[model samples]
Target chain A: MKKLINSADTILEESLDGFAAAHADILLLGAERKFVRRRTLKPGKVALISGGGSGHEPLHAGFVGLGMLDAACPGQVFTSPTPDQMIEAAEAVDTGAGVLFIVKNYEGDVMNFTMAAEMAGREVASVVTNDDVAVEKSTYTTGRRGVAGTLIVEKMVGAAAETGLPLAALTALGEEVNRRTRSMGVALLPCTVPAAGRPNFALADNEMEMGVGIHGEPGRRRVPLASADAIAAELLDAILKDLAPGKGSEVLLLVNGFGATPLIELYLMVNAAKRILDSAGVAVVRFLTGSYVTSLDMAGVSITVSVLDSKSTKLWDAPVQTAALRWGV
Target chain B: MKKLINSADTILEESLDGFAAAHADILLLGAERKFVRRRTLKPGKVALISGGGSGHEPLHAGFVGLGMLDAACPGQVFTSPTPDQMIEAAEAVDTGAGVLFIVKNYEGDVMNFTMAAEMAGREVASVVTNDDVAVEKSTYTTGRRGVAGTLIVEKMVGAAAETGLPLAALTALGEEVNRRTRSMGVALLPCTVPAAGRPNFALADNEMEMGVGIHGEPGRRRVPLASADAIAAELLDAILKDLAPGKGSEVLLLVNGFGATPLIELYLMVNAAKRILDSAGVAVVRFLTGSYVTSLDMAGVSITVSVLDSKSTKLWDAPVQTAALRWGV
Candidate 1:
């Protein structure tokens, strides 16, 4: 693969180094580079920590800042971080208020974070996210895999946590946010893991994998490449079917890119998705469109809808100072 | 080509509709969808207006909001907007303080913006950006073609305009920022325009175009695919040579992706660029990395270094609430 990296073996560390350097004001690298924690900690506030494989950038680490993740443990590309890494990150970022581990519903990640919480000498809780309605079981996950909606979970729960909520309360809020969110993705092109030096999968020029996972795992089905409106209809139909929002329910719509999709296309998808939602009688109170959660260089898009209550809507609008998602203050 | 678009004819309008819907709080769509202007304009503040091809998103349009461009016109993909679009944008956004046109140095863009300025009834000034050091003359430009450094010009000058600088002063500031900035890009893969339905250019699996333009134009030369470090050195060598900042000069280093390049690769490139800057005794006082300026879905990156003086540095740090670039606001 003609990737812009020195070597697959050193890609993660080198990228982490660069990330730490570039966002030094917002984050600090933990010892041995096991994790990245916010540079300034809010004492007595619940510390929210999250992490997963490294390929999905601006996910866990980019969310670390004033109103989001307190710390993030990044593993090698598509590999889970060790329990020791999570424990150390908890030790560093957890104030006396305790810690909340926001784990995606992946086998390796869940197991490791569970182990970390068990071994860590603190009041710790975990919220496992499984918002991807794309699959009940996948190559790396059981049940629905956590996808772009994980960002919504972190954002909403992170805002609530910043209000000095207890760990238990924050965990509940995170779980609630995840429950209200659903996501589905489609892949137009496969991504290459530098280590593998080949695409994770192959597709004919006129084909697309619908409901694909963030790690390039097989989705519901491969279909002929379709126009944006048709693709949006399929993805949003599945999401709305699972969500089953009331006729006038207000929601937040997120159009996330799977790395290679440009903003132009993502916005176009957003327009198509909005049209579909309008016809479905769902009111989109907020909209987010970008490549916040990405899979290497996969060319695709994911639609995330989170049913918003007054509290959740307020939290979603709350000021966030993360590297990837920022607004008011 | 596999793309998330309905049709080439509808792509621009659909994306614009989505953008206008998503960022309604920050901007408003002009009549006939000619341009996007700030939702809340400062009555007496100098207005900044910019426009170019639509493919390089978040450039002209995304930069419209508080502390940036007051209005932005988006042309068809890789094509310049008509002079009528620019004139209407100037009419819509110009306040008593006048309007400043930040035009990229392309044949069509420069010519159209010039015609707009001449026809504009209100006071008007222009700052033409030509920061690319790749070629003296290329397919669409005379002198060095403007590239990613145009973003830096808009940012720094946008901040100055927000402070109520006169159109003339803002124009001078923009030109000064342009003079201090230099950029170079490299493309690993060519992107396809929806209308073309084929890659803009071709390269062997082991080939890359160094010093490439944002539109996938031929660059300095085609070379064998090389490691990030080697590529970063060659790009920085040309940029630093052209800029020739004094030792210990502080600079804002921007590592911009050409759409399809992942954040991991971009940050790794930032690390590589930083190391070179350190060796050259230039301190990077600021860092902005992302796919701010992009070709459709080209897999590559561009590095921009803007030598910062005290005034320009302060302006760069000033609050900017644009959709794409936001910090300290």
Candidate 2:
């Protein structure tokens, strides 16, 4: 296994210490490896908490700040934070208004955060996002597990909560966004898990996995690699087929690059996506092209589109300050 | 060449289309693939513009918004954006206040953005970040060119600019931040650029390249693949040897995963990094762990430490909002 690290055993703790130092603006909780906002709570404002494994940069951690998630708990890489940790995070940040947990739809993430939510009880409301269109209904797993939809859910629910929406409203909005949003992705090559120091799976140099999940999971279908234009066509066809953004309906476009996919490729893909959408007559009002949430280093890309209304668009435009996923009107 | 993308030609445009649809709140010029905040520029605020090749997911584009760059132009994967594209970005986003160009240490990025800055003329004040410690002083290239230091300089100088700091003040603050920061990274495997949909370079499964820059450039040294613990030790030792985050000094630690590293490994590696710092008695105040900036599916990690002071600590604490980075009080 090839890596550039001092000692895997002590990596997390030391990294957290440095995290605290780099971000003195936030209160660092070493035990949980969390970066909490310095301001404990805003009177009458609901607290927002989000978490996931560590490898996906700036997802849970980056989204902690004003107009976004209040606190983000970090777990071991690719492993969900323990139930107790989430409960602790809930208790630590919850105000009178309540707390909202935005969880991606992974079995581990779902189970852990659900347990945490149950422990949180009336203290917070947890919303699970299962917006990945890559997966169809399955007997073993829940239908359409969440991939990048977590970002949409986070932005939407976070804004609603910031607007002083109660737990019920926030939950409703989160669900609505999930319902209206859809995401799908593919991988050029399997990522190498550092601890293991090996590729999760061996993919041929010319093969690409379609509908890949974030955790190095196999996609629904695997096929020979194609050009960027063809990949955009496939992904856009899937997304449009799933959501079908039509005339008079506004759409929020998110072109997310998995780790290792360059911005130029992402940019080029977005351009191809536009041609696809324009030809389809989809009215795209807002666009975001970058890696918002990502799997470790998988050479792939995911496209997420949310059918937007004025309210959701307004919330999307609201100023947000967090470690990741921040933009505002 | 292994990639998930269907075709190469249309990747950027298609990706942009998908991004805009998903983030309808943020307006993007569909023709140009530029990302601007949904909100109009406040009067009297100078526009801060930065951009580079497309592979650096959120670097130039994702950092567009309040308390950060006003606009970021997207370039082709691993290649700089055209000067015309940048000029358009500058013109569209400028709000009477001259724009500021933040260029990274790459020769292509520097050269291209430099041309754009000149084309932009007096309308923009450009500052370059040349702070990487790995690339030593040499007549062959700009000495120790910028790596992650571009981010710190942008955040600090950006915040100051938002607070209406003079251009000179912003430049001075940027230089100071660059002075205090040092970064060292390694690459486990070479990335396959979308255009060249195959590995740029080869690495034996047991080998690791140290002192690597973000692009798939040559590293200072290539050595046998070591355990994460040992790799962390070598990286931190090199970074620490150069940075010397001493016992009494406050330092912000960064355990950045190159693509393909799992968080569990990052966690373990971060813990390893902490012990090293603790043994040194560095007054660690902050730490950031994740894939903040990355090379395409490069299975490695980088350790960065910025010696901090009250001013920097406070500013670092100040809220920042971007897709890849966000934090503030």
Candidate 3:
């Protein structure tokens, strides 16, 4: 793989080191190198933590700061972080209010975070997000594979946590956010894992992997490449079908790129998505378009629609200051 | 080319439509669809206007909002925007303080912006940025090519403009920013224009282009791909050679991805850059890493180092909320 990395074995360590240095003002290395926590913790505020495999950057680690994740435990690429990493992160960031771990719905992630919560003697709560409607079963997951909707959950839950919600309330809020969100993704190119040194899957130039998972897991089916509008219609239809928003209902839209897609294309996809939503009589109250969640150099786009109530809208619009997403701070 | 574009002919217009729709709160389509301006302008604030060929997503357009450009005129893919578009944008954004046009140092850009300023029929000042130290001449220019350093100019001058700097002062400030900055880039892969449906340049599987321009122009030389550390060292060394930063001098370092490179690689590069700068006895007072400026889908990075005094540092730290870059607000 033509990647700008050191030795493949050192990729994780070096990347973490760089991430720590780049965001030193808001984050610091946790007790263990595999985790990162906020530089300062509020004594009575609920601490929010989320993590998964390392490839989906700006997800867990990049969100570590004020108004977002208090701590993040990143695993090696596509591998789950050990329970010890999660425990250390939780212990380090848990204020008297308690700690909440937002785990994506993957078997390894769910199990390890559960173990970490059990190991942590302090008050700990966990919320598992399974908002990806693309697949009910995948290589690394059972039921639904959590995908881009995790970003929405993190933002809303982080905002709610910042309001001094207790652990139980915060966990319930996270689960509610997950319940109201749905996501679907399409991949034009499979990403190469540095360790593997090749693409995880191969496809002809004219074909695309629809409903592909973040780690190149199986999706609905392979299909011939279509126009951006068609792809947008398909992904948006899938998400709205799963969401089933009532007419004139307001929704927050997220059109995310899978790493390699450029902003222009994301904007194009956003246009298509907006048109589709308009035709469906849904009002896009707020929209975010970019690579908020990403695969490792994968060329694809994902559409996520979250049905929003007034409280959810307030939480979503709340100020956030993080490495990747920031505004109104 | 494998891109998520519907058609080359409509890509620019559609992308602009999406941008306008997505950022409606902060931006509005100008008299002509070719230009976009901030939704509201501060009365008597010196307006900053910038534009260039399309494909450099989030450069000029995404920088428009709050304490940045008042208007942006996007051209066709890899083509200079017309004088008429600039005239319309300038007329719409100019309030009595006059407008400062920030043009990149390309023949077409310079000539067109010049015509637009003359036709503006208002007090107008223009500054052309040519901070790329890669080559004195390239496929599109007689002098140095303007690359990522334009971002530094816009941000600092934008802050200065918000402080009510007059047309002449903002123009001079932009010129000063261009003077203090130097940049060099390396491309691992060439980008393809959607219309062309092929790569702009060719490279062997194991080779990379050093000192490459944003538009895939000829660089200093091509070399076999090296490790991330080696690549970082090479790029930083060239920029420092051109800059010749004094010992203990404070600098703002920008490690910009050329669109397709992921954050992980850019962070890896930041680590390498910081180490090199620390060893060189130069203090990095501030730094920004991400794809602030980009070629459509090129896999590459550019390093910009700008010597900063106290005033420049304050300007850089000032709050500016735009779609692409935001902090300290």
Give fnat of each prediction, in order. Answer: 0.71, 0.45, 0.51
Candidate 3 residue-wise lDDT, B1-329, digit = tens: 67777888888878888888889988998765869899999999998999999899988899998888999999988899999999889888888899899999999999999998898898889999999988999999989999899999999999999998888888889999999999999999899999999999999989999999999998999999899999889888888888898999999989898888888888888888888999999888787988888999999899999999999999998989888888766
lDDT of 1 by residue, B146-203 (tens): 9899989998888887787877788788888999999999999999998999999999
Name the runs in model 1 displaced over 4 angstroms.
none
Model 1, total clashes = 0
**Chain A superposition TM-score per model:** 0.99, 0.93, 0.98
Clashing pairs in 1: none
All models, DockQ values? 0.82, 0.32, 0.72
Evaluated with lDDT, which candidate comes out highest?
1
Where does model 1 sit among the CAPRI classes?
Answer: high
Q: Each model's C-alpha lDDT?
A: 0.92, 0.70, 0.89
Candidates 2 and 3, the one with greater DockQ: 3
Expressed as tens digits, the lDDT of each residue in A189-268 for candidate 3 is 89999899999999788999999999988789999999999999898888888889999999998999888888999998
Predicted structure 3, TM vs. truth? 0.99
Candidate with more favorable, higher lDDT: 1 or 3: 1
